[model samples]
Target: MRRIKTRVFVIWSLIVVAAFSLVGCGSEKQTPPAAQQAQQVELNISAAVSLKDALAEIQKNYQAKNPNVKILYNLGASGALQQQIEQGAPADIFISAAPKQMNELEAKNLINKATRKNLVENKLVIVVPQDTKLNITKYEDLSQDAVQKIALGETATVPAGQYAQQVLQKLGLWDKLKERVVFAKDVRTVLAYTETGNVEAGIVYKTDAISSNKVKVAAVAPEGSHQPIVYPVAITSGTKQQKAAEAFTEYLFSAESKAIFEKYGFTMGK
Candidate 1:
């Protein structure tokens, strides 16, 4: 009877060990691997007011090709844009209508010097209201008392204003009509003033005048009137999206992008 009891105990011990092993294997925890991270980037661009049309088109094309990237743009007078960038705006790239303001930013180390490139060229032109049939072609005609007020960008900092001042000086009309000039914050403001009849005439860019049917070109400033107009694009040093920003700077030089810029009356830069 004692031997039978011993055999039964051994059989029960083997069954218990087998049950324990099966439970350990069945209860093992399996955790799913973590989800893969998404690769999305946002790029911010601050550009001159003159680039509004071209930038809009370029943004569309870039997004179509790179679905992962999102672009945000700030467009204003070149001086104002430079001020914003200096004040720590989160700008990935900058496109300035004039080089002087860009040089100032570059001096302050606000933008990457190596990434700078002359993207396009523009021409200045005088404009008048569309409905008004003004035959005042020569720059000297602007000095006539009938002209009352002529609008231009503020010459102190605005590129368009500076160019206008130079043109007036070249034509020997600046001293005669200084008092009659209506200063605007930017070239677009000058266009607005002329379109609304607030000023008899305005000095803006040829590309600008072509965009608006509300005004007619009075004359394109002769090449000698002002320094050559060149647009420069640069990548800001503060950008967090370094690769995206660099790609964008290069995109400005792409032939497809140049065609879009030319559609807005911009000339190809040398």
Candidate 2:
């Protein structure tokens, strides 16, 4: 009888141990795998204000595809954004309306050189209020006596202004138009001035003119009047989100991004 009891006890102990082992295996299976749980990341994109609409669409598309990544935009004048980055403001990527701001950052070693690339091309144009009797049909017309005030981006900081200056100088109208020019804080402000009829005319990008029905394109800057209007994008040297920033910048040059930009009147740069 005692031998039978010992056998039964041993059998019960083995079953208990087996049950615990099964539970351990089941618990291990229930745990989520590290690979399945992606780490969430945030990327800050400092882009030109002119890119606002296109980028808004692009961001929605990208975020839909990449649910784990969050994108926040810092849209403003390229020069102002460059200054902010230079002064240690937080930014992961920088997209300038022209190469001048990017060149300045590159010279200062503030940008990731390997990630730099020209993103898009734009045309500078003169614009006026949609319903105007100014008879402003060309760049030459901007110098006429009827044109009391003209709005331009501040040449010291705005690339559009710099381009306008170049075009004016090329056309030999810089000296004559200098006194009539009203310096705006940014290209969009120049557009605003024209839209509000605060200025008789404004020099801005063709893309900007397409954004508003309140303004009409007077004339496009003649080819070779200024440097090629190419926007350049790069990662900031001090960015903490290196890989994520690179991924977003790569997306900016992707076919989908190109389509969005084209829809907004921008031509992709080679």
lDDT of 2 by residue, 1-270 (tens): 999999999999999999999999999899977875656888888898888889999999999999988999999888999999989988999999999999999999999999999999999999999999978777999989989899999998899999999999999999999999999998999999999999999999999999999999989999999999999999999999999998888898899999999998999997
Off by over 4 Å in 1: 1-38
State each model's CA lDDT, in order: 0.88, 0.93
Model 1 poorest 10 in a row by lDDT: 29-38
Best by lDDT: 2
- lDDT of residue 15 for candidate 1: 100
Model 2 score (lDDT)? 0.93
Off by over 4 Å in 2: 1-38
lDDT of 1 by residue, 136-203 (tens): 78677887778989999988668988988999999888999999999998888899999998989999
**Worst 10-residue lDDT window, candidate 2:** 32-41
